[model samples]
Target: MWMGEGFVSEIQHNRGREDTMDDVGHRYLRELVQRCMVLVGKMGSLGKIKTCRMHDLMRDFCVSKAQEENFLHINNILSLKLCEVQNNKVRRLAVILESDENYIEGVKFNEYPYLSYRVCCKLELGNLNYLQTLVNVRPKTIQIPTWFKFNLLQVLKVRNKKGAQDAIQMLISRCPLIEKLHLYGHLKKLPEAHQFSPNLAKLTLSGTKLEEDPMETLKKLPNLKILCFRQAFEKISKYESVGRASFNGKNMVCSKGGFPLLQYLFLGTLYYLEEWRVEEGAMPSLCRLEIEFCSRLKMIPDGLRFIATLQELKIIDMPKPFIDSLNEGGPDFDKVKHVHSLVLKSFCQRMIIVSS
Candidate 1:
């Protein structure tokens, strides 16, 4: 919230000549400035004004009256300004820099002695009651608050170098109804045979690996519509006894019932593509598929038999035979009358057109 001297001069200039200022004129102008600040701060806390406006207004007020305001005066007014925030606190609350840092510097927790209001240094999402989506990139480790139980959470993204994966599992376990989840580098091992939310629609697991196959976790998600595995590098030792590591083979992706409602699928540079068990009835509703940088793929399994409604298929940086299998299948061509576009790229580019 740093303001240059030029800004102060501009405000004074806008206030007009000192000679023209009667007692009423000075009083009204000062009151007007204070009134605007109070209204803006209140509106910000009430979630009426955009967050940016609140930050801007606070910055301007602070800069305009630096000499007149002290730490206590500023802190008291800002606290009163923020008291208007009602219940159902926003999960994605962005604490702008203009927010009262003195007030932010006052939250306290007794148990975590190492991380008091002082160690925390800033108040990001401490006092919020309904925060479900939180991703802060400060030097702090996000520990899930105990009060946070099953709520109406649908999306979560968190990144911390330490305890990254554990945090993700904790959130997933807590929010059983979460519909979409994206994790970037947080999760050492997938949950050990736990039931996932049946309402899960989209999942993105990036930048992590596991000693065990994570297919069982996917099996728990009955309503999963979109699945993405991006840059998830697994240890070579994890696949020692595994058969050919390719979803493109005679026997790949196999499950009890398969992806019953899955529609979109993306597998990116995943070293252990062999873990996918292209089970029968899996991907019954699959429509879009993209496989990129899966060098280990030998062939796409014939078990992908029931993708009857597939519309778009994309294969990149895979073996020759894998591409051949897809070309031979013609995209369950009998049922996928809606599928008119296909893209295959390797050393060259080829586009195919299909019609009903």
Candidate 2:
């Protein structure tokens, strides 16, 4: 999200540097952690912070300062009217929706789990050419203007856009610099992966019941580095959505040359995934892998056994039989023996099998 907003992305790092925008973003985050601006909420397989939380005092101060400077704005449609934004100029905006307009005005902030505050927005996004990040805006609320040209937008997030496939595609086409996209809604169709922004590096989708195999399509994305899917392919009743927990299986195959610069992969809560194949050279730069609650997956892919770059593997909420198979001398044990750190988590127990 920081990268998309050009927070750390546009930094003219060292001349002729090889670091990616995503790498620069992480390096900035690490600096924040060192400064104690936020607290780590969750950790990934490779010990990177997957989520973070800010203290109430810090959060409020930042929000107040940002709004005062017109540097950031929060358009909470439930209580605050869109037309009432302090200033017309904002570099980044977060559009929050709450169907019920009546609510307690908490001293700090309120959380509205239900969405949809529509049509009254009237804010012309087409005029906000300086905008860099537009997050959590519902298509039903603010229709993307036909003349929209957000050349500086780098991060876009949309929620509960049930039937706005064409509008979503059109909106994406207008944001030439968009790099991170997150879609959360029950979607029946998906835009062609090839049509995605070529500069896109991070993508996340949730609750999308795509009729087409998403992997087969997404594998075509040229610059994708980080990908995540939650409850998109798995049986909804068997597994609930886990934020930022990436892949949920649906007949996925990692073909050769797919996600060439990818470093992190995650699979979670896929109930019927019985097999997964990874061809040689697929995700060749992958360093961290995580598989969680994929109850029916029978064995680890044979290709993992040969991915010399793989560094960490974490398995969570898996069946006992699956855990046994990765133990010493077990059928699939050798496949993961080379991993530097191997950890597994079950409902009642957590254990580390190996560490380097």
Best by TM-score: 2
Taking every candidate in turn, the Cα RMSD to the unseen true structure, in Å, is 15.3, 7.4
Could you tell me the TM-score of candidate 2? 0.67
lDDT (0-100) at residue 294 of candidate 1? 75
Model 1: per-residue Cα lDDT over 1-356, one tens digit each: 01111212222334575431223333444464577653332331112232222357686766557535422122343343343323323211223444445325433322210121223454444344434344332224445466665454545554434355545566567666666666555356665435456677777777654444555557567777887777633344965532222122221344657667778888777655553446557677878878776767655544454556777877786665555555536543333334556665653435432332
| TM-score, one value per model | 0.54, 0.67
* Runs in model 1 lying further than 4 Å from the true structure: 1-127, 136-140, 144-147, 160-165, 192-195, 232-252, 274-277, 328-340, 347-356
Model 1 has a clash total of 19
The lDDT, on a scale of 0 to 1, for candidate 2 is 0.69
